[model samples]
Target: MLFSLLQPALIMKISNIEDIPGHNIVEFYGIVQGSTIRAKHFGKDMLAGFKNIVGGELKGYTELLHESREEASKRMIQQATDLGANAVVNVRFSTSSVAQGAAEILAYGTAVKVVPHD
Candidate 1:
């Protein structure tokens, strides 16, 4: 996996806010985004149907969304890295139903280079 190949220190920072707190953004590399569509398998779908009738949380769907979000974030980070960004700011996520059983997860942010405030 890409994450496995990347050292922790080499991974770009990400934030939902416009700034990186103690750091200053010195360059803007435009917006970067990543997205993925996911759906449950037939067995999980059947289980989800049963859970819906029971009026409870669908664990399978929850896990699927979680994994999708992770993937989307990873892709977004990769794009930022490709642009030579050290951090991403103003990050945001959006979700939309792509089909009856599938949904798309999107991650976006402004890629930037940052330096510690002097």
Candidate 2:
């Protein structure tokens, strides 16, 4: 009874579908999370009168933001998995300002486990 053992691990109850593992999901329910990210500005302040018609890439800032969002999403997923959830659905993403100089990204969805019929 692998599924029985993973009962508590399930987070979502799919009240819609009754089959799972092949795109047809069972009636289970869970929560899924997602995040979005944006680049950051560095110590080098933007000059008041300087404007580039084409936006030059900011490597460090871009990397920092992309990595941060990825880490955050992974953490959320891991949290769900640790709880014994096997699948996540209806995931959505969002972003917001965490501070004056930093932003936060979030990913959310339904976490659940599929139970097969006899």
Which candidate ranks first by TM-score, i.e. highest? 1
Residues 1-118, candidate 2: write the lDDT tens digits. Answer: 9775445335433222333445545444456554655546554225211333446765555676678766666655665666666666666566788776567788666666655455
lDDT of model 1 at position 54: 82
Model 1 has an lDDT value of 0.90
Spell out the clash pairs found in candidate 1. none
For residues 42-86, write the lDDT of model 1, one tens digit per residue. Answer: 998999889978898988889999999989988888888888899
Task: Report every candidate's CA lDDT.
Answer: 0.90, 0.57
The TM-scores of all predictions, comma-separated, are 0.92, 0.55
In model 1, how large is the Cα lDDT of residue 36? 98
